[model samples]
Target: MWNKRRRHFESYPEIVIVHVSGYGRPESGGDPKKCKRGCYDIISQAYSGWCKLASTPEHEVYRLPLYAGNYVTALFGAMEMLVAYIHAQKTGEGQVVDVAQFEAIARIIEMYYTQCIITLEY
Candidate 1:
């Protein structure tokens, strides 16, 4: 796959690219407008499909628990894409913009970890 893409890029004098990684590309991934708890849970849950907020076909919003950093990251990613798009339009160049689900969680976790480490001294 890499070789094929490299060959294709040979045609362009110097083409720019924008890359992202996640459950799937934002285009292939579900719509961000109406994202749900299920979408976020896919990555947040250590055990996949293990602890789900009880909801029926007619979901009762009041019953839903807020296990939702995934949604926050998804929305943040969309915002980043908008900025990247504007940059590309103005400069006529593109760049890679990766937003991995686990990676985003890891970042948040590390910040928390740092706090724990700091408290250890006290």
Candidate 2:
């Protein structure tokens, strides 16, 4: 189904295709078994360490009160789409934007951790 759509879209150079998934392209890396699994907000949070960051003092972890993973994934997906669209406009060639929800959440986590590390004294 995706292959067919990709082929069809190949003719439309101005179109920017965005593929958002839980893990990412199966051929890329990670557990192939999990690549077949679909991910939701809670799943992404758990896999991406968001739940750990949101854990209570007792070490009881939980999903964010809101669906932060979903929203963040969407925001990142949108950003990728826009950047790909701009590239396509300039090159007159369409491109696929592959966004993994896990990576998107991890990016936010990594960004926060990096900032903390930079500010830490020891």
Q: Whose lDDT is greatest here?
A: 2
lDDT of 1 by residue, 1-122 (tens): 45654664565423444443433344445345423223354454332221222323465322224655566457657766788778767876554455545445455456545554677421
* Top-scoring candidate (TM-score): 2
List ranges where model 1 is wrong by over 4 Å: 1-64
Q: How far is candidate 2 from the true structure (C-alpha RMSD, Å)?
A: 3.3
TM-score of 1: 0.46
TM-scores, one per candidate: 0.46, 0.80
lDDT of 2 by residue, 23-79 (tens): 987655657888889899999999987787667667688778688898999999999
Which regions of candidate 2 are displaced past 4 Å? Answer: 1-6, 27-30, 111-122
lDDT of 1 at 106: 50
